[model samples]
Target: MSRFTELKREVYEANMELHTRNLVIYTWGNVSQIDRDASVIAIKPSGVPYEDLKPEHIVIVDMENTIVEGDMRPSSDTKTHTHLYRHFESIGGVTHTHSSYATAWAQAQMGIPCFGTTHADFAYGEVPCTAVMSDEQIQRDYEEETGVQITDAFAVINPEEVPMVIVAGHAPFTWGSNAAKSVYHAVVLEEMAKMAYLTKTLDPSRAPLKQAIIDKHYMRKHGKNAYYGQ
Candidate 1:
């Protein structure tokens, strides 16, 4: 049996969840999970439809983006995934999607405001949107540069505190302790994005939820004294 059998299975399921949850359509997204000890990641193969995806189709690539196993090509976003794994030491998985509402915010170059407890519960503040990619950066390796944009936006934000980000003029990328959790964050991000849009549409003059409420909601679930789930 392949040493990466379980890893591939988990990543495959996570990628399917993106489709099943309506976070992705056609071949618009990818998900990946790292095996830190092995210095490898199992990720969705490039351009493969989720409906036809199977466990063995999951590609395993190293930190340097070398294919270690699999018959299919890794996601075109493979470099971005590897770059993230290299820079974000604490994160074990990453997911990227072009889900409608989140992509709308990304294309508008606006961050999703923490309008209520739901947003605050997942993200400490407005879900950040990376600065638009410069012409020079785009001229570089575009996929790798995408990772640079994400890390730059995260310079002041803790990945642990804000597990997701939307790339300006692009889409959303979310990370977590594992592949499944990253997909969960992606779903949460999409819902929050939808809610924020409707709220703004309904009240253009409305303000963000106050900092006190944001803190209360976030801390109750994630702070040092957290007691949210049993």
Candidate 2:
């Protein structure tokens, strides 16, 4: 039930695209994929720059962040992705990035209130940011605590449907049923965040899309009537 080496190559390429496109800088982001048959994920190793990244650098980890294969350690955010795969039955991939304005919203500890069609199209409404971290959490190592925070962050939102959240004082995390779409959501979230930022600056009280429009847009690309692709 092992994944093909080529699949790992594809994941590595996508990870490189994030840096190449400026969606990430330094050593700040990661992408991972779950292999359903084996209950394992292939993740980019920690702190490797995009140029130096090699497909063989992808490490396979189980649901609990225990490395199963490969020579390097998984991304520092491995536990966060581990928590997601354990909780959301349908989530096959998870991605995290500190893409500018999205991190701005996360740092501000506020949700990205739905602004315009672009935001609505991807998120159905506003992209939610978790409330500020508790004092105990803030006192600890932020990244490990971020894993705990994000797991708790979705308490009020439906993770299966929403598929993304911004951790307070941290950044954005997005997921989908596969690696490619997970990256797609990361890119889309950044665009939506930028759009929402400009909207708030120009008009402070902008509201979420009406429920009717939200429902129509969400359903047309998902659920029983989805028409997005063949």
Best by TM-score: 1
lDDT of 1 at 180: 97
Per-residue accuracy of model 2 over 1-230 as CA lDDT, tens digit each: 34558668767877877887688987889998888788888889999987789888888888878999888988988877887787777888888999998899888888887656566567766677776777887687565567677767677677766777888778999988877778888898888888888888888877766888777777777668689778
List TM-scores for all candidates, in order: 0.99, 0.89
How far in Å is the alpha carbon of 143 misplaced in model 1?
0.5
Residues 64-98 of candidate 1: C-alpha lDDT, one tens digit per residue:
99999999999999999898888899999999999
Alpha-carbon runs more than 4 Å astray in model 1? none
> Which lDDT value does model 2 have at 223?
60
How many Å off is the CA of 37 in candidate 2? 2.0
Worst lDDT run of 10 residues, candidate 2, spans: 1-10
lDDT of 1: 0.95
